[model samples]
Target: MEMERLDRRGLWMAVGAFVLWGVMPLYWHLLKAVPSLQIIAHRIVWSTLLVAGWLFWKYGRGWLRETLAHPRAAWMLALSGGLIAFNWGLYIWAVNAGHVVETSLGYFINPLLNVVLGVVVLKERLNRVQWTSVAIATGGVLWLTANYGSFPWIALSLAASFGAYGLIRKLVGVPPVRGLGVESLYLVLPALALLLWGETHGEGGFVAHGGVAAWGWIAGALLVFGGVLTALPLIGFADAVKRIPYSMVGVLQYIAPTLQLLCGVLVLGEAFDRDRAIGFGFIWLALALYAGDGLLRGRTAASAAAVDT
Candidate 1:
């Protein structure tokens, strides 16, 4: 019972972490003056350094050695690294490009995308409610696309990439912080290469005003703070996954996206047109269905498990 209680506490912590993650637009807003690509690059570079330092401090050099020891793990880490970088880049771009609302829309739709991933990749079965939620969510997305006369490809890309990244993380059994450390290491090389290339041929690199103080300070701060900030929620999430079911996490994930959507429409002054309203309404309905399905399934599973015991 004590153990169960501890786990539940940890799960709540995880939920809190996710909530912090949802509030990230507030952070990005601070860096709004910086170019999105520059912000993205700083995120990569700084996060890598921070994670590296922490991993070394916590696990010593041996941890780094072990991460590189297994080729398969290394490959998975590399792929995950690339995917997350793209995700970060796209997210930064979305926020800076006044598409924060749509970015939030992508996250709002992510759980459903995860459901689709589960069905297609994990071969998991969805009951009637789940199926209905999926259908409704699909309808919502389609409606949004129809309204625009073009697909919200950016939104879809973020959702799909992130869903895939989650699936890959599930498949790879590395511990959260250490695994993330390895992923950062994989990204470091490319990031450095680009930084070098940009300095020489692209845009003079790092120094925003011909010295390290201009945008360099901002970039540096972002790099270090970005990784540490990201790591906090991730660690919290890892703790939560151990204590709480994935279904619970899925439910909580909506908090961040919902906030992002609001920030977009309310703060950033993004349009919430009539068509968008209609589509969002349908999406909300889909989320309701999805939440209901998860709850019902969880109760049934608990009952069955009790009976078995």
Candidate 2:
């Protein structure tokens, strides 16, 4: 019962996280005027400050000491931090550059990668149905890539970085918030330095000129809000991975890209004509196959356990 409830909580957390991620294109669109690198630097700097303050208050000093005492966790988060930073930079650039649809395609491809990684690294097994679903999904991604015009380096990079980050966070023995705080800390210095150089060179978006922000006060506020937006979903994601199977978490990720696809087509006015739609259709079919099979299997296992008891 306890484990069941934990899984239920994990399910909701994952859903919430994906939903937040799906709608994030709109948020990034608001900051399209800002340079992507500057935006990412602000994200790291502000997110670190926010998380650090929270940790300092809660743990009352020595928070860093506690986190770093675990060298393995620290090292893993350093790698994850760098990966997520790269992912964030690319994602924001893609959104602002009008590649929302292609960005969605990248995330659409991530779940299959996650499944393979889980099996290879964590020894998670997939049945015949799951393997079939994986093949279909792979076909969908290939179809999208071949049809989407230019090569999708942005999409592939985003997918790979986030997939690896998720796997590492899942394996690390640390609380979600604390782990995120530490990850932010790892990149905060470089992020600050980047912003400093940008401002000094007059290329930054957040600097104030004549007591007014270069891009207006609202944009500055939005830039700071980026930290909050980025951290919340990630924390929930970490918790979800801790409580549930990684493969299931990956399948559940379909929510994010689906929402992102809609945002790109409807809100952003991207060209999502028949060809793109057809490719997305194949991916959707695979999601349904994997998700339905998992649900059916879960019910069967629960019923069998009840009978045994």
Candidate 3:
């Protein structure tokens, strides 16, 4: 009963995290008037300050020193930091530019890309079912490219950048909070510089021009609140992962992109014609196959272990 209750709590936490992520396009949309670079700068700078402040409060002055105790931590976090920054910038651009649907496609494709990364970089092997699923997903991408009248580079780029970030993190294996704190720290200087440059150039989103009051108080508050929006869900996700099975997490991951798709179509009123639907159909089929295969394999292994015991 206790374990079941814990799982319930963890499941809700994961749901909240994914729900927040799924609806984040709306948050970015609220800042559509802001230049993507400026928005990214605010996100990095504010999130760095917020995350670092918490880390210091929780772990004291030497927290950072302990975080970097691993000789390679600094450099590895730098690389991951760069990748995540790129992902964040592009994602905000896509969302605000009315490519929210394509951004949804990117996340839908991300898990499959992770598998390809595993095979290529980690030398991990995929079984026949997994291989078939990947092949079908590839076909889905091809179909979209061939029929959708334009290359979905936004989606592909988002997937690739995030996949590389995950690969880097996996190779180094640092705790999530410590890694994020270091990554944010590494980006703080550049983010601050960008914000400085933007304000001086008369194009910053944070402030109004002389006596103009263009952005207003609400927008400014949302810009600062971007830090909380960015970090809180991630922290919840980390905690949820600690409390649940990875397979459960994997299944729940789809909730994010699915909600993103709904938000794009229903709330944002983006186009979702038959061609895109057909392509998404293929990808969905592939995911169903892959997930079903995983469940079957997991159950079989568990049953065999039970017999042995």
Candidate 4:
């Protein structure tokens, strides 16, 4: 009973963290004064600082030694970092451009991408229902493309990038915080170079216009918030994974994107055309099938385990 209660707590924590992440566009809206690229640079720079400090505090010199000891892992993590950076930059640009609706659509489509990645990259087999879900989702995307008369490139790109990032992270097999810390370190060099160039070329350097108080502090604050939010959800996810079955956690993963979708349609006032609605409907049906398949498979697996025990 106590264990079950703890699982519930962890689950709720995961949900709350995701909810906070989902509503992030509202916060980004306030930072519209800054250019998107500049904001992204700040995000990388500040998150790097925060993650570096936390790693040093937690692991002392051992963290550095371990990272150095595994060059392959380090390189993999660095590549993963780049992918996430691109994802963040694009997401920031999309939000600032008032495409939150499409952004939400991207995340909604992401889980399906995850399933595809699992099948292709991990050599995992999807059950019939899961396969059907993927097919349905593909149809939805096609419908949307036809409706728009051109591909919804932004949405597709966001989903692809983020899904690829997640796959890379899974393949790397490092602890989430540790992996992210190393990736942030990897990003630091290019970010510094960009900041330098921006300082010389544009008025967008963190604090180039004024010493350090101009808008650097605000950027720094956003970076800190982003890092905290990023880290918290990751920790919550890890915790939930330890406590609950993957089947449950997998289903709950949709909560964040669903909330984002609601916020996009209701709060951001993004329109959903007829074709887009049809597309979303197909996607929703696909998710339902995928989830139903998982539940059934989980039950069968549990029963087999019981019989064996």
Candidate 5:
């Protein structure tokens, strides 16, 4: 009963986290007047501050020292940090530039991309179902490209960058919050430099111009709030992973992109015609196959272990 309760709690937590992520396009939309690059810079700066402070409060600085002492981890984190930064900047730009639907497409395909990365980079073998799913997804992408008269580079770039980030984090094996903290720290210098350049050039959002009252203060507050937005969902996700079976979590992950798709079509009024619908149909079929295969394999493996024991 206790375990069941815990699982239920975790499910809710995961749902909340994914829902927050799904609706985040709305938050970024509010900051549309701010340049995407500047928003990313502020995100890095403020998230570093928030996470670092939490670490200090929890562990009293020992974690930071230990993390910094490992040269290999630092290098790996640096690369991951760059990838995440690129992903964030692109996502913010995409959301505000009316590419929310394309952004949704990116996340919808992200899990399959993770499977491909695992095979290529981690030397993992895929079963026949997984292989077929990948092939179908590839065909879907091809169909979208051909129909659209060009590549869906925005979606592809978001998926590839995030997949690479996940691959690196899997190999390195760091705690989620701490890993993100370290990545944020690694990015701080560049982010600070960009903010400084923007301010000096009279283009920074956090400063007032033309006698606008309290503009700088409001912008600064919103920028710091970005850190809270970044960290809260991460905390929920980390908690969820501890209490739920990963297969369930995998299925739940789709909630985010589904919400994003709804936001794009219903809320933001983005175009969604027959061509895109056909392309998405193929991708959805592939995901259903992939997830069904995983569940079957998991149950089979558990049953085999039970018999052996």
Candidate 6:
């Protein structure tokens, strides 16, 4: 009973996290007037403060000290931090610049990219079905590119950067919250410098010549709340990952991009013509094939183990 309850909680947490992520474009749109880079800077600054405080409160100074003392871990986290920062900046810019649909496409393609990265970098092997799905997804992307008259660089960049970040985190074996806290710390100095430069050049958004009220105070409040928005989903995801099977988590991942696609097409009134529909259709079919193969393989493996036992 207890285990079942925990699993249920985990499912809800994971779903909530993905839902929040899916809706994030709406939040970023509210700060559309702010430069994406500046917004990312503030995100780094505020998230660092909040995460650092949480780390201190939860584990005392030992966790931070130990993490800093491990030179290799620190270096790996720094690299991952840079990748995530780049991803965040690009995603924010894309969402506010009317590339929300493209961004969704990138995330939809991310799991396949992760599988490719695993095969190439980690020497993992894929079955025939997995390879077929990857091929289909590739075709989908190619179709989109050919029809759109150019490469989908925005989507590709987002997928690659995030995939790389996930790879590094997996290799490093760092606890998610502490790792995020360290990553935030790694980013703080550069972010602060950028924010300072923006303010000096009259480009900052939270404040102006008059006061906080000039930005309606609501915007200022939202900018500050960006830290909470950044951290909360991560916390939920960490909790979910700990309590649920990774395959289930993988299945749940689609919720985010699906919601993002809906937001772009329905809420934001983005252009979604027949060409896009065809491209996305192919990708969706590819994902369905990929997921079905995974579940079938998992069941087979479990059955074999059961028979052996």
Best by TM-score: 2
Q: After superposition, how far is residue 95 of candidate 1 from its true place, in Å?
A: 1.0
State how far residue 258 of model 2 sits from its true place (Å). 1.1
The digit string of per-residue lDDT tens for model 5 on 1-309 reads 477578779889889988998999988887776778888999888888898888989988788778767657788888988998999899999999999988887876676666666666666677788788778877876776678656789988987887677666666656667777888889999999999987777657677644323455877677779978877776676666556654345446667877888899999999888988888788778778877887798679778878999
Query: CA RMSD for every model?
Result: 3.8, 2.2, 3.8, 4.4, 4.2, 3.8
| Candidate 6 lDDT | 0.80
Candidate 4: stretches off by over 4 Å? 1-20, 193-220, 234-254, 299-309
Q: How many clashes show up in model 4? A: 0
For residue 111, model 4's alpha carbon misses the true position, in angstroms, by 2.4
**Poorest 10 consecutive residues of model 5 by lDDT?**
207-216
Query: Lowest summed lDDT over 10 consecutive residues: which window, candidate 1?
Result: 204-213
lDDT of each: 0.72, 0.89, 0.79, 0.70, 0.78, 0.80
Off by over 4 Å in 5: 1-18, 209-220, 233-254, 296-309
- Ranking 2 against 6 by TM-score, winner: 2
- Tens digits of per-residue lDDT for model 2 on 1-309? 899999999999999999999999999898887778988999888888888889999997788788778759979999999999999999999999999998898899898788888889989988999888889988988998898888889889989999999999989888898999999999999999998998887667766544335458788899899989988899899999999889888889989999999999999999998878888998899889998998899899899989999
Q: What's model 2's overall lDDT?
A: 0.89
Q: In order, how many clashes per candidate?
A: 2, 0, 0, 0, 0, 0
Hey, what RMSD does candidate 5 come out at? 4.2
Q: Report the CA-based lDDT of candidate 5 relative to the real structure.
A: 0.78
Off by over 4 Å in 3: 1-18, 209-215, 235-254, 298-309
How many angstroms is residue 72 displaced in model 1 relative to the true structure, after the best TM-score fit? 2.2
lDDT of 4 at 45: 74
lDDT of 6 by residue, 1-309 (tens): 588689879889989988998999999988887788888998999888999898999899899887767657888999989998999999999999999998987876676666666677766677788678778877876777688756789988987887777667656656778888999999999999998997787677666633333566676678889988987887677677567654355446667887898999999999888988888787778778877986797679778878999
The C-alpha stretches of model 6 lying farther than 4 A from their native spots are 1-17, 209-215, 235-253, 296-309
Q: Tens digits of per-residue lDDT for model 3 on 39-130?
A: 89999888888988888999997888987888688898899899889998999999989998888888777766666666776676778987
Least well predicted 10-residue stretch by lDDT in candidate 2: 206-215
Clashing pairs in 5: none
